[model samples]
Target: MSKKKTAMPKITLIVLLSISAVLLILLGIWLVGELKDSFSDPADGTEPGAISTSVSGGDEVVMLVNSYIADMRKDKTLTIEADGVSVKLDLNEAGAPVDYDELESYMKSKGYDTALIGQYKTVLEAQGEPGSVYNDEYITKKIDELAVNVDTGSDTEYELIEGGVTFYRGSERTVFDKAALADSVKAALDAHRYDTITVSTTKEAPEIPDLDELYTMIYCEPADAYYDVDENKNTIVVDHVVGYDIDIELIRKELTEGTWTEKTFMKQEILPEVTAETLPQKYFKDLLGQQITYYNTAEKNRTVNVGLATAAVNENIILPGQTFSFNRVVGERTAQKGYLPATVFQNGGMQEGLGGGICQVTSTIYAAALKAELDQVSRYVHAYKVSYIDLGMDATVYWGSLDYVFRNNTEEPIKIVSSAKNGTLTISIYGKETRPANRTIKFRSVVLETYMQEMKFEEDLTLAPGAEKKIRSGMPGYKVELYKQIYVDGVLQNEVKINTSKYSAYNGLTKVGPKPVVTDPPVTEPPVTEPPVTTPPETDSPVASGTTGEDVPVVETTSAPDPNSPGI
Candidate 1:
C-alpha cells in the first residue's frame, strides 16, 4: 500500500508538468503572432520581413529624404566658369541638384530600408517632385546665358559705293563645350557637393560672308538709254547704268592673306550700246513725214479738243518694233481733263458728245504715219464721210473700244511733233530715214457709185398757210475707192487700191403748210331751159376734140414730180 500511494503522487506531478509545457508552447506562438502584427504594414497586411525600417508611410519616407536633401544643399554654391565667363547657380532653389538614386543611397546610409526608399520615390513622383533641373534643356539655357558675356565681334559687313563694293573685317570669338560643363555639374551634384567647374573652350576665327553670293548681289548687265514719259506728261531720257565685274580669285587671295584694304577689290566698267548723250541725236535726226489739216476756227469746243489731243501726242517717242496706240496715249476725255462737248456722228445723225473732235487728231496722225511708211496694226474709218478728212482716210477712236494703232517699222526710234495754230493743225514724224529721197506717195479717192437723197414732206401746224419750211438738208451717199500712188522722181511706180468705203444716204425732212380751203361756186339753175335739143358736133378733117363748136374750154393735167430729185 505504501508503494501504490507514492506512484500516484508522482503521476500527478508529471501530468501537471505536461499541462504547463503545452500552455507555454501555445503562449509562445501567440506572442510571436503579436510581434509580427506589430511590425507588419496594416494597410497592405505585409509580413514583418517586408516592413520598412522606422519610416512607415510614403509621406514619412519622403519627409526624411527631402530633409536630407535640404540639409545637403544649405548655403552651397555651384558655378560654371570658363575663360572670361562665369555663371553661378543657387543650390537652395527648387530643383535641388541631387538625383533620386543618389538620394536613395544617402537614405540607405541613414538606416532607411530599401523599401522605404522606394516609397519615398513613389511619394515624390505623386507630388511631382524631382523636376527636370539638370536636363538637356537646362544645360543649353545656362550655357547660352553664359555665352552672352563672351563677345565675338560683329560678322563681316559689305557696302556698295559708287563703282565697287567694300567689306569690313570681324574679330575672333571663344565658345564653351556645353556637354562637358553639364556633365561636370551633374557629377558634382550627384556627389552631394558643390564646387566651381571650369568648362573647356575653343577659339574660332570670324566667319567671312560667302564671296559668290556677294558677287551675285553686286553684278548686273549693262542697259541702254531709253525715253519714257514723266509724271507731268513730259518725255524724258532715262540714263543708262554702267555694269561692273570683279575677279573672285584675287579677292579670295587678299582676304586669306589678311592683306585686304578698302580698295583691294577692283572692277571693270562695261559700256552700253546706246549712251544717253547721243541717243536723241541719233534717233530723231531727219523728218520722215508730215501732214496738215484745217479746222473751223469758229468752232471753239472742237478747236480746243483738237489742241488738247495734239498736246497729248506731241513729243512722244515710239521705239523700233513698238506700236503706238492713240486712245491709250490720249486717255478718256472728261470735263475734269478740260474737254468740252462738241458735234459727233451717232447712228446716222449728228449729236453733241465729249471728245468730239479727237478723231480729227487720230486721222491726222494716221495720215502722217502712212506717209512715214509705218505699218498699220489697227485702223477704222468713220461711220460716215467726215469733212475734215477725205473718205477712206479718216480714223475714228472711242474710249475703251476703238483705237488707232501703228508700229515703227524702222530700225531707229521715231518721235511725233504736233501743233494747232489758228485753223491749221500739223503733225510731223521724225525718225532715221531709210527710204529714198526721191520717193513720194499720195492717196486719191474715186467715186464708184452715187445714191440720190430722198425728200419726205410732213404737214406742219406751226408754218403759215401755203408756206413750206426745210428741216435737215439731205446728204448724197457715195461708194469710193481709195488708191495709193507711189511716185519715184515724178514717175509712177505702182498704183494700188487701198480700201473701198460706202457712205449711207440720209432722207431730207421738210414741213409744209396745210392746203387752203376752197368753196365751189354755187350751181345756178340754167334758166330751166333743158328743152333745147343739142346736136353732137362733128368737125371736118377729123379734129381731135371732145367738145364741139365755140371751142369748149380745155383742161390740162400734169403728173407729180419725183421726190428723189436733187431740187425736191
Candidate 2:
C-alpha cells in the first residue's frame, strides 16, 4: 500500500509539471502575437502578426503621408478676383510656400515624429500653418494663371484672294498688371483672408495693322514661266504667277470716312511677261543637226573621257540668248573625275594627258552646232592640228583658262543629245526647224600655206654605234582658211570665208647612237683622187601628203613607227 501511494503521488507531480510547461509555451506565443499586432498596420489588411517596420512598409508609410498632404491641399481652392475678371485655381497646382523637407522639419519641430509621419499628416492638416505660409513662387504662379484668364482681344481674321483682300476687326482687349496682382494675392494670404481679392486692370483698344506694311507684304512682281527638271528627270514647265498691288491711301481714306463694310479692297493684277503658253514652242521636238564620229575603242581611257563629257552635255537645254560652255559643262578633268592619261596633242607633239581624246567630242559638237546655225560666242583652236577633224574645224577646250562657248541664237530653246557607243560618238542638236528646207550649207577648208616638218636628232649611249631609232613621225603644219558656202536647190548661192587657222609644225624626233669610230684601212694602195663627179641638184621628196594640197618634208631614213603616235 505504501509503494502504490508513493508512485501515484510522483506521477501526479510529473503530469502537473508537463501541463505547466505546455501552458507557458502557449502564453509566450500569444504574447509574441500581441506585440506583433502592436507594430503592424491594420489599415494595410495584413495578417495581425505581420510586422510593419520592414523597408517596403516604411516606404509605404512615407508615401501615405505625402499623399495625405497632397489630398488635403488638392481640395482647397483660391480665387483671384480682378476688375471684371475672376479665376479659380486648385491650391495644389500652385507652387508650395515651402518644400517637403522644410515642411517635414517644421512638423518635427512641433513635437511630431516625422518617422511616424503618416499619423501626424491629419494633425498638420488641422493646424495648416506650415503648409499655408506666404510663398512668392505659389503667388506668382497663381497670378500667371489669373493673367491667362484675363479678357484679351479676340483674334483678327483676314483673307487674301486672287484680286482682293478682306479684314475683320476683333473686340478691344484688357490687361492687368501681373506684379500688382501678385502683390494683392500675397497681401491677402499674409492677412489670412480667404475672400475674393479685387484688383484693378487697364483697358486697351485693339491695335490696327499698318496698311503700308500690309501692302508691302501683299505686293509682288509677276514671275515669268520657266522650265525645270522633275524628280523623275522629266522636263516640266512651271506656270507664271500674276502679281497683286493695293493702294494704302485709298484704304486710309475709307477708314477715315467710315465707309468700310468688310474692310475689303480691290487689288491690281499684273500679268507675267512670259506666260506658260508663250514659252518656247516645240522644245526638243525637231532634230536641228547631228554629227557622228568614230573612235578607237581600244583607247579605253580616251573612250571613257569621251563618254563622261558626252553624258555631261546630253539632254542639256540652252534657252535663246543663253550660252553653252564646254568647260563649264564638262568640268575640270582630273583623276578624281576618272579621267585617265591618254595621248593628247600638246606643244605641237603627242603626249600623255588627262582627258586626252575628248577634243574629238568637242570638235564633233562644234560641227553639230555650226550645222544647227548657233552663234559661236567663243572658240579656240588647237596648237597643232588634231587627227580626227579637218585643220580648221576642231575646237579645243581647257578648264578654267579656255572654253568653247556658243549661244542659242534662234528664238526657240535648243537641246543637246549626245551618246558614245560601239566605237562611235554622236551628238545631235534639237530645236524648232526655222530654216528653209531648200537651203543647204557646207563647210570648206582651204590650205593657204604649208610648213614642212624638220628632223631632230638626239644622241643615245644605249644603242650601238651609228644605230638610230625613230621616236616620233613628223607632222606638217598649215595655214588654212575655213569657208561657209550656202546653196539653194543644189545651186551655189554664196560662199563666205569663216576664219583662218595656223597649225604649228611638229619636228620628227630620232634617238641616234654615237657615230662609228673611223680607222685607216691599213693605207693599202694610196687612195687616188678623181675629179669630183657633178651630182644633179637634190630635189625635196614628199614623205607625207595632205588631201588639202599641203606639202610635207621628206625623211632621210625610216625606222619602226612609234605605237603611241596620234593617227587618224
Candidate 3:
C-alpha cells in the first residue's frame, strides 16, 4: 500500500508539470496578440501624455470617420460674384457629421435605397448627393447672371426707348430682354458698399414770354347819345357804340398776371407820379376828340372842339411813381385834324381863322384834372379868361406847341375816361380812390388887380379919289390885365395870371375932297391947255365928319404889329 501511494504522487506531479507548461505557452501566445493590437506601431516619440481609455480595438473605426469628415471639409468651396464684384469662400467641414439613421431616411426620401455595410458602416447608403450638393460656385454664377446695367439720365442724356437686352459672359450668352435694368440695378446697389459718382451733361430750359409782346389800351365807353332832359320826354336813350369791340378780356388777363408790368419802360406811357414838367395852357390835348360848348357872357356863344383830353389822375391809375405828360400822349394836331375857321384871341385882340375853339377843349380838361386833384405839373390860363370851366382852372392850347402833363404817384393801374358831347365835355378818372368818397374840391379865381391900359379903336373910314368920307371913324381902345387863382378843398393852392387882351391904337387918316368937277368940265371944252384952270380948290373942303365921304381909320393889328418892335 505504501509503494502504491508513493507512485501515485509521482504520477500526479508529472501530469501537473506537463499541464502547467502547456498553459504557460497558451498565455504567451495571447499576450503577443494583445501587444500587437495595442502597439501595432509604437506611438511617435514626440507624442507625450497621450491618454487612451475607452477605444482599444475599435480605434480604427473612429480614425476612419474623422478622415472622411476632413476630406469633405477640404473639398468644400464657394464663389460669389455679381455686377463687377467677385468673392471666393473655402469652408472647413462644409458637411456635418452623418446621422446614420436620419441620413438613411433622408437618402430613402430622396428616392435612393440605402443599406448598412460590414461593421455597421453606412457607405453613402442612399447616395443623396452627399445629402445636399452645396455648389457655392453654382449659386454665385446664378446671382451673377441676375446682374444688370443701370442708367440715370443726366442733363444731356438722350431719351431712352428700349428694346430687348442681351448679356454675354465669354461664350455663355443670355438675354433678359427689356427686364428693366434700372430696377435690376436698384436691387443690386447696396449703399453700404458704394460711393456716388456723377456724369456731366448740358441742357437748356424753355423760354418764357416777355413784356414787349404785350401791348394794351384803356378807355371807358359810355352809353352813346344824350340825356333827353325835357322833363316830359326825359328818356335815357342808351346809344350803341359803333364798332364796339373792346379787348376787355386781354386787358384783365394782363393786369392779374402782372404781365402789364413788363412794359413799365415804354417811352410814351404815363406814370402817374408827381414830378417836374411844364404844362401848356392847352395841354389837355385828348379833349380834341369831343364836341364842346362854351358860355362866355362877354363873348357870343360858340361851339369848339377839344385839343386834348384825359381822365382825372388818381381816379385812373397812371401807374404810381411814373412820369406822365400831355404832349407825350396826345401827339400833335395839324390842319389834318380838322379845325374850323373862326375867331381866336390873339395878342389881346381877336384874330380871324387860325386855330379857334381849341381853348374850349383845353379849359374843360383843366377843370377835370383839377377836380381829380392830380399833381399839377403844368397849367396855363386864358388871355381874357373865359368861364367854361371856372377861373384858375383853365388850359389853353396852341396846337403843336403847348401841352399838359400829370403823373400817378400811386401804386396801381389807372384808367382815363374822357368824353365830349354837343355842348358838354367830361373827363373821368377810373381807379382806386385814395380819399374818402365824400371829399370835396373847390376852385377860386381871386383877381389880384386888373391892369388897365389905354388903346385906340378905329371906326369906319373910307376914301374916294379926292373926297374923304368918315363914318364912325376913330375911337379909343383899352386893355385889361387879370390874375387867376386855384383852390382845392376850400384851400388856395396856387395863384396865376390870366393875361388880358392887348389893344392897338387907331390911326387917323387925312382926306381932301377935290374941286375936280369944274376943272374937268373946262378942259374938255377948251383943248385942255390952260393950266388946268385951278378952280374948285375949296369945292368940297375935307368933307366934314359924316357925309357921302367914308373915312377909313387904320388900326395896327395887335398880333402883327411890328417886326422890329418889342412886345409890351
Candidate 4:
C-alpha cells in the first residue's frame, strides 16, 4: 500500500510541472508582441514636430488656394463712394498683398473641407477689404497724390490743402455732404489696407470781418497834452497821449482773403496837439501894480490878524478875466482861524471885535487893484473913516454881508504878493505890463469940508478936589473927493473924479470934580525911589509897546509918511 501511495505523489508533481511550462511560454510570446507594437516606425518616417501636407491631391489644390487669395487681394481697385463722390485706392506695390505663410497657417488650423472656400468668402464679405492688406508707406505715398495747392492769400507763408474734397463731385453743381465724405474716408482707411492711396481735402474758404467793429478798435482820437499841477509835490506833471488810425482797404482785403491776423492792420500815428516843449512856463512875469499902507504894530492882535490875512493873499494867482473875492480868498475869520479881538469901526464908533483888523487887508488889496487897473466887481465903504487908510480908498469886508471883488481884465494873468514888516503893509501885483511905460498914475485927494467934534464934561466922584482928567479924545471929521491923475511924460493927460467919502465926528468927554471938600494938612509919607529910566536908541518914529499900560500911547507914528493915513 505504501509503494502505491508514493507513486501517486510523484505523478501529481509531474502534472504540475507541465502546466507551469505552458504559462511560461505564453507570457514570453505576449511580451514579445507588445514590444513589437511599441517600437514600430510611423507612416512616411517624418520627424516629430514637423508639418506634412503631402496628400493624394495634386498641386492644383495648393495653387488654387494661393490663386484665390492673390486674386482677391489684387483683382481691382477699391472705390469709396460718399455723397456722389468717388475715391479709388491702389494696391499693386510691395507688401500690399496678403502674406502667403499666414494664409497657409489659417487654412491648416481650420482643416481642409468644402466649407473652407465658404469661410474665405465669409472673411471677404465681413472685412469688405479689396486689397486685404496694410502698407503704411505705400498708403502715405498715395495720400500725397491727392493734395492740392491752395492759395492762402498770405504773402508770408505758402500753404497747401490735402485730401480730395469737392463741393460737387459727381453731379453738376450738387451740394456734397462733407460729413459723409469724412466718415467714408475714415471707414475706408480702417476697413482696407491699401498699398499706395492717400486721402486729402480742398475747398474754397471765406473769411469776413465786421468793418465797423474793426474801425472802432483801430481808430483813436487825438488828445492834447496838458499840465497837471501836484500841489503837494509843487510840480507840474505832463500828460502825453498818442493817436492811431488803421488803413481801411488793406484790412478789408486781408479779411476777404481769410488772411487777417492781429498784425495785418496798417496803422498811422498822429501826434498830440500840445507837447511838453510848447507848455506855458510863467503865467505872470512883469510887475503890473504895487501899493503900501501903514499899521500900528503896537496893536499886537491887529498886527497878527493882518499878517494872517496877508499870508493868505500872498502867492495867489488870478487868471485873465478871473475875479478875485476878498472874503472867498481869505476864508472865514474866527478864533479857530487864529484871529483876536481888536478895535474896529462899528456903528460909527470903534468897537472891539474878532477879525477887526482884516479890513486893512481888504483896503490894501483894493488900492493895489486900482493901481493895476483891474476891473472892480464890488466894493463896500465903511460908515466912518478909519485912521489906517484914506477916507475914499478904504474898503471893508464882512462875512456874508460885504465883500471886495476885483477882476483881472488884462490880457495876461496876474499874481498878488503881500508882506507886512516894520509897521508897513505892502501889496504888489505881478503880471505882463500892457500899459505904456511913459504914462504915470497917481491918486489925488481934495478935502471938501471939515468939522470939529463937540467936547463935553462929566462929573467924577473918584477924583480929588478941583482935579480933572480927559476920558476920551475927540477927532475932527472931513468930506473928501478922490481922483486919479494920469500923466504922460510929466504932462497931465487926464484927471477923473473917482469917489467921494464922508467921515463922521467922534465925541470927547472929560471927567471933573463935582464939589470941593475941606480937609486938614495930611502927614507927609516917606519919598519912594523910582527905578532909573534908560534912554532908548533914537529912531525917526516913536515905537510903542504892545502892552495896554496907562502910559502907552493910543496912536503910533513913524517918520516915513503914513501911507495908510488920510490923503496919503
**Which numbered prediction scores highest in TM-score against the true structure?**
1
Candidate 1 scores a C-alpha RMSD against the true structure in Å of 14.3
Tens digits of per-residue lDDT, candidate 1, 394-419, equal 78898888899999899888999999
Q: List the pairs of residues colliding in candidate 4.
A: 142-198, 143-198, 162-200, 162-201, 163-200, 163-201, 164-200
Candidate 2, run of 10 with poorest lDDT: 559-568
lDDT of 4 by residue, 1-568 (tens): 3544457788999999999999999999999766433323224564432222234221333445656555545655655433333456554442344544545565566564433343344334444634344555654443333321212232232111121111111111223334454344445545444433223334343324456665676677777655343443222436656777766676455544542333433467787776555434445577778878888787788888999999998977676777788887788889998998977767655667888788888888988888888888898877656776666787889898899999989876578989988788999998888788899898888989987787777887776555667756666777889899999999999998877878776666677765655455445455776545986565574454544444422222222222223311
Query: Which residue runs of candidate 1 sit more than 4 Å off their true CA positions?
Result: 1-79, 83-102, 105-114, 120-134, 141-196, 199-304, 315-328, 331-357, 368-388, 397-417, 421-446, 452-476, 482-499, 504-568
The estimated TM-scores of all candidates read 0.52, 0.47, 0.33, 0.48
Ranking by TM-score: 1, 4, 2, 3
Q: Output the worst ten-in-a-row residue range by lDDT, candidate 4.
A: 163-172
Instruction: TM-score winner between 1 and 3, please give it.
Output: 1
Q: Tens digits of per-residue lDDT for model 3 on 44-136? A: 332222222224423453444444434434644333333334333333222233435543554456554242212224222322223223344
Candidate 2 residue lDDT tens string, 73-136: 5655668876667776555554334245644765566655454553334335534525444556
Question: Which number leads on lDDT?
Answer: 1
lDDT of every predicted structure (CA atoms): 0.74, 0.72, 0.39, 0.63
**Model 1 TM-score on a 0 to 1 scale:** 0.52
Winner on lDDT (1 vs 2): 1
